[model samples]
Target: MAKDFHPPYPWQTGLWQQLRHDRQQLGHALLLYGRAGIGKYAFARYLSQALLCKQPHSGHPCGECASCHWFNEESHPDFRLLSPEQAAESDDESAPSKKTKKKTQISVSQIRDLNEFLSLSSHRNDGARIVLIQPAEALNAASANALLKMLEEPAPDVIFILVANQLQRLLPTIISRCQKVSMPAPSESQALAWLSEQGVQNAQQQLAYASGSPIQVVNEQAQLTTLADIWQQLALGSKLQPHLAASMLIAHSAETGIIALQKWLCDLLTMRLTKQVHYHIGQSGALQGLSDKVNLSQLMQLQKKVDELRKLALHPLNHELQLEALLVEYTRVFVNK
Candidate 1:
């Protein structure tokens, strides 16, 4: 049986019931919009499985069925998942000698290829077809336009489920065509409870760092140690070694390192201005000590640079060097002891 063949998250129970009960009222295109790392993609997947299940029980997928098996195996004939990574895979089959940059946009060609799939009838005569576009914001202008045409004249019994974290990035026409479903974010209590159920340690602290997203906390478990080390180095303020810190910071990826820096900077600002830390709840003492020494204007300037670096994290640039420069700047932002 498939691992993902389970029910929706506990917090999503109500919404799931409502959606399942009103399945007939759902539009051909469903826009599931919400904050990232809040299980929106998981919800979409569960819904898709349920829709394609041959033996759906009480509006849920029966894990024992052939359709469920196919879906779990990612070989369902009636289902297609359109994502930037998927588009990249289809476009680049040749093995690259060097480390190639990952693709970030769904190309127009990926959208155009769907025409043949849309024209074909479902594998099961009476079953429905599903096209799931995750992080729909990844659809570039050309691809978005191509998708719009399909949405305007959708195929018979075909459901287009678009999942998005940033809803504002999507075109207005696309938003208007679909039935928007506002996926709920779990409350702090709900999130903590879920984390506890999963046997995650330091749930409250992790939850705060993840911006209350339970899913993100779970996903970032392995990086917790690295993040803690980064925080300790950051707390060193003016005495921090830029070169050594830069190597450790970008150990995972340039983006991850940048985000960690951004969050640390955010907490520093919060601590400096309001005497309260948001993300780094457990680092209050360290933040307070550093915040007092931090030059506000200099910190803000470094924050802007970090933001810019994060935006260009995917580009083929010397991230380690850039990060090292930023850490050096970070050191300069604090007064000498």
Candidate 2:
């Protein structure tokens, strides 16, 4: 995190205070978790810094301290960040799958490498050292077991803070070794107000489109506009040109386009079976028009195909052609009986 980065969101203030109040009582490892876009990772970072700071004051770290400078520069000798992307590179090896692509799992080799760091004492006298692992779910079966060993025999003066978007995805045994901190998801009003403060117009629309993740709204504003265009193409049903639509979607990513379609079709199915739609509340008219002409059996088959494609989205396939084929099938669902 940069020194100029914004503080935690308003909803996090209370939780921050709680952590401060129980600062001294904190365990060796902390599992901070909540839904995606709730700022759990940021909170973990803030806590890591505060704990490592040589001069903490008034419930926060003093940024002027040498310790703070080292942390901000990401060169603190005692501080380590264990994230999937970082782990893959830190092991002095390229990803076995794809050199450029990020691996989702934290390798066991990375966990074992921590033995050297854990063996050392803090760089500063009596000051805490922190190891922050984000999205703890990235620790697969082997990595989780390796981590479990460390948790069982925790090194003195070293703290492990694990941040996760999905706690259920983590190993239950690993979870039992740490203290769980459930981060709060801000209410819709709070999110919209925050977006408004950030000078984001059409806050409600953006927030809804992001499934209430304010961070995603801020990060993906441009993509949202592209999504709107894609939705318009999707509404064309039988008239939609597969190649053109596929190009636009593949430009973003195969996974992203598949997810967008999944969510849209989910709403379409809801609109078909019942008169209500959960996501894409703003695109009801277009979805309603498509849902009527869609054959239920074929729509179900298309959804299954999309799910399968999503599973293989990372494979080295001709993305544009695959999406075009899916879109060709998509148009068939609207054909007259």
All candidates: TM-score:
0.94, 0.92
Model 1 scores worst on lDDT over the 10 consecutive residues at 1-10
Which stretches of candidate 1 lie above 4 Å from their native place? 1-7, 94-99
Could you report the Cα RMSD, in angstroms, for every candidate shown?
A: 2.3, 2.5
lDDT of 2 by residue, 5-84 (tens): 25568788899998899988999999998999977887788888888888889779898899899989989999998888
Q: Which residue runs of candidate 2 sit more than 4 Å off their true CA positions?
A: 1-5, 91-97
What global local distance difference test value does model 2 have? 0.84
Q: How does each model score on lDDT?
A: 0.90, 0.84
Residue pairs with clashing backbones, model 2: none
Residue-wise lDDT of candidate 1 within 1-337, one digit each (tens)?
1233234988789999999889999899999998888899989999999999988999999988999999999999999999988866765666553236778988899899999999999999999999999889999999999999999999999999999999899999999999999998888888887888877888898888888888887777888657889888999999999999999898988888899999999999999999998889999999999998999999999999999999898787899999999999999998865
Report how far residue 116 has shifted in candidate 1, in Å: 0.5
